[model samples]
Target: MQGYILQIQKIKDEDCIVYILTNSSLVKSYRFYGARHSKITQGYKLDFELEHSMTFLPRLVNTMHLGHRWLINRDKLFLWQQFIRLFYEHLKELNDVEEIYFNVLEECALKLDKQNAKRLFIEAYAKILDAEGRLHNCDFCFLCDYEIGDKVALARGFLPSHEHCMNQNGFDKDEIEEFFKTKKSLNLSDETVNRLYNILLDGF
Candidate 1:
């Protein structure tokens, strides 16, 4: 199976608990420490086998690291970690997460070093919200139901609002609309993009 390692917590001596997000599920497994044990860490995409036992956590076997070329760049590595940490935290509550979630992670991991990391993250997150049905796609303000004008503001959960409703201004409605329609923010200014990304950081 292939998955991204979301977290690792040290247990008793020579043991640890591993949280992994696979293509279709979130899994928690046990790792017995050993010199030969595959080196696992948060945000690593790896291919491995699992040895399931009746009474113990599934054991990871024959782990192989994949798509780690981004690690060679310090900036990309930092951004990649931040991206995966957010992804893991957002999906931890669900056991049967959609496969699109994993595919997004893989896509982000591969493209992290290819473009502006912040831009890549925001685009990927937009797709995630769309996939999870959390993206607000209406023409009216989410807060007041008023028609959205030239400027807009985004609230937590990516809900669109009139700039005045949020006591903010300067976000172009067309750009946000394009983002919702295409999951891409090519025409948005850096300031607007960062504002949207900040809303995401506030939660969901």
Candidate 2:
């Protein structure tokens, strides 16, 4: 089966503990000589088998990296890693999550090389919010509980707030509404995208 390596921590000798997110679950497995597996890192996808022993932790074996061209670019890879870690924090406590979670990552990773990572970051986060049933209508202020006027500020999770209510001038309301409806960060400035993406780092 295939899974994304969310995290790996070194143990005694070259052994390590790995946390992986597969289509249906979050898994913790062991790997001896893990240091030798340079391609197995946060944000990299691997196809592998897990060995289970009654008295021992599950073991990772027969791994193959499904590499991406963007991963070799240090900046792109770093952003990808940062985006991937959000899944670990969000899904770590659950034994199972909706397949949409994994699908969102898969879809986003495919486009990482083709689009601006920040744009994809915000758009991917919107996908997650939608899948989880939290992408609310954006016509009102999340804080002040009033109709939003010309512009809207986004709190974490993209809940909309009126710019005046927020004491901040925000992205154009139509653009934000369009983004929520379409899941595209079209027309959002790089500066605007960076702000939205930063909110995502605070986690869903």
Candidate 3:
């Protein structure tokens, strides 16, 4: 199916919960604004139906209601839809948090020869992972083979994920390709970059 623009807000808390906020009025009015006989009551009913029936809508709601701090924004819904399609459907990529945390540290470490940068990277990973565990309230971590606890960072849209699962999935590859393609090229450690490269070699 063709993707449509959607106005979306992606909220992230220290505790890894991502919330999506949107202006529902615009969503409902998009198609029926010029429909014959469209009235106030009909608009309400249509809004109710569209919000309720769409599978992705509920996920956004749950994120907002549950998370302590929510990320909020108003943007074109088409861009949101495009992001979802690219990350979830086409490449099965991971989220922004993971990319930033790992990429930034890796870049700092290699280009500047900074061990502290690597330390910060690992630290950030732990912090975010802890937040993910706490928010989801599950100890079982997918990235770590052992059920270290009850939390597994279920791959949500626009969030970071554990390093291992990021590799097992295609997120790492997308990160590398996208990173190199960007003008501000990344400085990834040889081992870390090679690991990602090997995964890409294996393919999905």
Best model per TM-score: 2
Candidate 2 lDDT by residue in tens digits, 65-136:
998899889998988899888888888788776788788889888988898998998899998899888898
Compared with the true structure, all predictions reach lDDT values of 0.80, 0.85, 0.29
What is the per-residue lDDT of model 3 for residues 1-204, given as tens digits with 9 covering 90 to 100?
011222223233211112211221123112222234222211011112222444333211111111111112123222223322222232223322333333332232233322332233333333333444522322334445444222122343223344455543433434333432332225555555434333222211
Off by over 4 Å in 3: 1-4, 7-26, 30-81, 84-139, 142-146, 149-204
Clashes per prediction?
Answer: 0, 0, 15
lDDT of 1: 0.80
Q: Judging by TM-score, tell me the better candidate of 1 and 3.
A: 1
lDDT score for residue 185 of model 3 = 23
Residue 59: error of model 2 in Å? 1.0
> Model 1, which residues run further than 4 Å from truth?
none
Each prediction's RMSD to truth: 2.0, 2.0, 16.5
Supply candidate 1's per-residue lDDT for 38: 64
TM-score of 1: 0.89
TM-score of each: 0.89, 0.90, 0.19
Most accurate candidate by lDDT: 2
RMSD of 1: 2.0
